[model samples]
Target chain A: MLYLALGRGAWGELLAKVKVAAIQARPVGGDFRHPGNIRHALELLDECFRMDDEVQVACFPEYFPWSGGDELARKAEDLGMYVIAGLAEEEGGALYNSCVLIGPDGAILGRQRKLNLGLMERKHFGFSPGRELHVFDTDFGRVGIGVCVDFWGPPNVGRELARMGADLIFNPSFFFIFREVWHCLLLARAVELMVPIVAVDVAEFPFRLGDKVFESCGGLSCIIGPPWRDLDDFASWWYEPKFNWILGQLGYEEGILIRELDLDLARELRGAWFSRLLGREAPWP
Target chain B: MLYLALGRGAWGELLAKVKVAAIQARPVGGDFRHPGNIRHALELLDECFRMDDEVQVACFPEYFPWSGGDELARKAEDLGMYVIAGLAEEEGGALYNSCVLIGPDGAILGRQRKLNLGLMERKHFGFSPGRELHVFDTDFGRVGIGVCVDFWGPPNVGRELARMGADLIFNPSFFFIFREVWHCLLLARAVELMVPIVAVDVAEFPFRLGDKVFESCGGLSCIIGPPWRDLDDFASWWYEPKFNWILGQLGYEEGILIRELDLDLARELRGAWFSRLLGREAPWP
Candidate 1:
């Protein structure tokens, strides 16, 4: 059929089912250099690995244990799982909010700089914005990271990532606003990109920049997938969008949220509709 | 100050408050040539005008009257309201799904052809797709129309329209699938485009193409607005996206659903955030 002809890659084997964990870590008194905070975040990662040995990927929200790149790299190697977490990177006397992805082999895979800097980040913190976007190949599939407002505000960042064949997108956010707005925006991105989004947010914390204290109402970290996957069942074609398709989520609390994603199913569902609708050789724009 | 600087047009006045009606119409039998169907649809339009003397714009679902161009122009002139409705156009032996906009002065303002054609539309019906997109300036503001699948599948059609400064989008659909899925897709479009979407769908009807009988599960006609408008209140910043921003909606029934849309507010909200985040003078991509 047209779907099979225009679909990406070969049907092959559906062997890319992956379990992911969102480590909703809390900040330690606005101090990324705090040894105790780094240690506590490491303990959460280790606990997550112990809780689910099958977990292949683990993520943390923005700037929690912010300066623990070496520790996370070591932990990923020790646990044999890919680790993605936010960082407050300082280079040449400039600060930029970033997310680092470490391979299971203990090597730093890559880092995605936050492209869209928030108002406070620019005016108060004097943060610099990133210029480019990237997608990395992993054992499970291709992955992309969108830090905080980078993915939420501009649809282009996430759209470009998905167009580059990102099977999954990991969003590290320190959203200080309402959680529902974030949820709605994230859900919309997931549906539009046709990619599963694993977004982890920091627990509610008081962020201090200068004399301004902004309390982040975080902990709506969640995983969202395509709703069209249900179309496989003939009856599901009549299903309503009344209910959200968020696979797993955490409320306003500090915890670890895990969910299993079927990358094969996502690809199939996305390919079938996009190919049929787009009628182009490429599955996407 | 930055928002006012980069926002579209002068914010000297916020005078545009448009009363719009979505005529959730039902097809009469299976023929567009049926006089009864055209008469019924026109009567509904008249009732809508009588009900709200201030109603500025009125819309109908795709292909309800199928081929009533002259009558709608006359009705728009008589009622002094802009009319947007779908049609089945036949040109040079090629058929296209189109939506026409009739001005209050009985002038054919413009027509937008469906850029994306569905599988059934292409194969069974031999319908051709349109090449260009346009935005029509009306009494209230700039308006764009996305016919059925045109606005749902691809993000560009709506994005391009929004980028071109469409304050309000009128989507005429004969969605035959599940209503919930349609709702979710349209909601995503409204949020992403930052434009108010008035989507009117036909009631449940059995569409017969040759011997194949396809039932359209329609009647999810609705008006959706941006959630960011609520940010005017400082407390609203904490409000969740839990409650839908759909101003008005109709269930699986034939009726006239009307709602007041503040185009001025939509532009201000979209510009404020887009300019702040995008940091560009255009306020859009």
Candidate 2:
């Protein structure tokens, strides 16, 4: 029972005219993972803070050296915008795909382990499904996190997250050229949540994940919400995704994908006008 | 108001199976139409009687003949099906897509033209919107007819038909591949009618229309109602679309797909199930 919606944005087929803040990620050895350790990762975090002083959150591509979780959680305190980046987790000689949300105070806010494992993902990295959705409270608002395939399950994951009090949902994705199904799923999730579900697909850099190196995953760093409240004022509104500098093919080089949050719309729209059809009673828990 | 409902058979893939007494249609040259010409079309009623004897009625595809409608609906009788088919009226050299229904007695039962159309369709053949949907009486029960795409517009076509007095509805559709969006509309129509609807897709021989062949238009024919049904002994316990004689795979060749229908169940589940939902108002017309 929360107020939420998404700002739908177009994806990049080719780069164009906007300036963007890009989070250039480098590999740290995956072998250096611990539940709570960080030295070199912290140094890397210092570089991220220095590069974008106003960055609220910096994202990383999937399957990078993810051992920096606890460290990013701490680094978020200094970075101020918080940190949500992907990392390959090492546990008991096995690897798991995971994304962590580090709080502005550098605390571990939430974690969502990838649920749908590709054949190679399951083989090279033994990933077990994440059991529950993660929605945490922050001074900014209630935020939720979900990895790629976790968003695809038919039983309404996005709606569930919205119902769990998420004002913002961060979806860090790695898209592919032959893949059209996932794009539709992302749009459906945004419509279902009716909140700003920022889906950041990797761009430019190609890295090998098994036999393939994906050079361009395409970028559609969108701010999805219901139709803009004032069509005339759309260009100037802070909540309007078009106004977010982090969007557009050209804008996201290294600037923050920023937008102000309004927590009330998710609350009032539930019953006053359009009934929550997604919340209709069904034969499930 | 007349009671009406729209129904379709499942997976009416063309010529996939050989049907025992399936109706085969050949594209005719002259104008073929039926509008308010009940006794006129019923003249060849005995031909259907000679072929199948107890056929009750047979259906044809949408716009079976290239008829000229402005000329007092010329060639209203040559429409092939005991049940009339959709027609494209050639006027001012422009085309108006339509569907007309004839009976086993060769009477014009009713005709409903399609209203909503897509871009490609609008470009190729012009269509006039169907303003209303109504049902008429028959020996079997109150029945109605609606063309393809008519169901897509608010589904009020079926609802209005049901409200008018249709216990059964015949919806003959023509499309290369079965669209899921149409299926969703069918599901919604069945749920709303609380009556039986026999949806028969225009299953026929593939040939050329203009540049398109008439017989080569592979069709999927079906008869869907309550997926399960219990009827009076005189009433058929089950209907089967076992006509598997579709040959050659232009990929559209699937034969008659029939399934027994249970109208009573529509009343049971979608109807007044005696104090269901803790006494909410009846949802159907």
Candidate 3:
């Protein structure tokens, strides 16, 4: 792991460069079913690897393959990649909407359950909210997950994760409403936390359920990096490539978005930014 | 008062429409001095009122006329408009950077001191971070102020104010760098809190002190409203007027930006949006 635990408190070390893939695939749960959805996601993952063999992390959208966690873990072990995907887990007579992190060794590393349940998830699906937030350590850096609205809503889980020293945040969302607002939020979260965000959302698709038709307003899966370290690099930070904080993004379509993230820069930025708040000297001049 | 506090927890009522003015003026502290900056600000306020006679609230930038609270309050009483301005406060043998809210009656309503001090503030000036946060009630609505970097920094005071039932927020800034990031943050704060933000920044100007010249990178004062309630109002929310969440804004020049804010719509949106998360029906279908 890039971060090591010292005696009193843990200090972070410079992280390795990470090649990440955010898969914008069709919905895996609800009327779409699971086994087939899981198969499709696996196929997409394989395709992503073929395109970029060095991809270290692969993220799938929320509720994609909402079950069948074992399959994802097995795939992670086979491909020697970190697999992050949303799952619907049943335990203690309660169902949870969760995002699970499967390690390269086929171990279920950990899971961050959705803390803020949405209206549909509460009223109709009877989903219970998660209690604790967790950060998982990886070879590249420490990472945290906030499922869908948990990242967007109040008591933002992303903020908590960033405060816990996560270098990067993964948001597995099955989002549909307010794309513009969501875009602004993603940027805001990246800036506020000083951490890059790997947000993957399910692709748009219409489905039929016993004469009722519903369409998913998913897609806009993106990888947003932290803000610029040197404002002097551009005359106006909002113009041209300077404000291009969205490192890589996919539209409302089914595909994979890949980007090589400099976790070292992100970690350094987060450290420098927070340290200054404590009346410490910033690393930059 | 537009909102009456009921028993148990305070229940909010719809607020009347309010016309607000955000004055973007030159720096008033340090080399610029006190009474001169205060005079300039008052003249700008008069000019704003002349432009929009019904302007009910006037906000000035941080540290501009940083020590003239009495004059601003008296002017507020004279104009019969609520005045919000930044002040360098001396209390308990400690000097603090604070924003004061003065009612139309010339009464000092409340003040929110800077909770997170900047490096220059702590090291160069020996400023102390404030211990308390406050919200002031007026005829239009309850409001909160976050002075400069306090609103932008971690443990954001703006978020706390919004959670404390502030219908609107005022950010008095003397910002110089990373304006693009600041813009995104303002919009994000508005959306996160479900409250509008009236952010007034000092206009850009150069000042000389002991043979050294320092220029202010101020301006970009803006009024950002809450996100649109209806997404279907536009085909693509990111395009044109829909994504133009910054209702009114000024460039890096000394001027006053005034706009009529429908606090009733803001209150309604906030209540409905939060209620939906708690499994209640949204007002809109």
Error of 3 at A192 (Å): 2.3
Residue B49 in candidate 1, Cα distance off native in Å: 0.9
- Which candidate has the highest lDDT of all? 1
The list of candidate 1 runs beyond 4 A from truth reads A1-15, A29-35, A123-125, A204-216, A226-245, A277-284, B1-15, B29-35, B123-126, B204-216, B226-244, B277-284
Candidate rank order under lDDT: 1, 3, 2
Cα lDDT tens digits, model 2, B8-54, are: 12332211111112222333322233343323223323344455444
lDDT of 1: 0.75
TM-score for each candidate, following the candidate numbering: 0.84, 0.44, 0.81
Model 3 TM-score on a 0 to 1 scale: 0.81
lDDT of 2 by residue, A17-87 (tens): 11112243333322223333245446655765676565555555454335666566756776665677777
**lDDT values, one for every candidate:** 0.75, 0.45, 0.73
Which clashing pairs does model 3 show? none
Residue B153 of candidate 1: its Cα lDDT? 59
Model 2 root-mean-square deviation: 15.4
Top candidate on TM-score is 1
DockQ of prediction 3: 0.27
Better of 1 and 2 by lDDT: 1
- Give the lDDT of residue A253 in candidate 3: 77
From the highest TM-score down, the ranking of the candidates is: 1, 3, 2
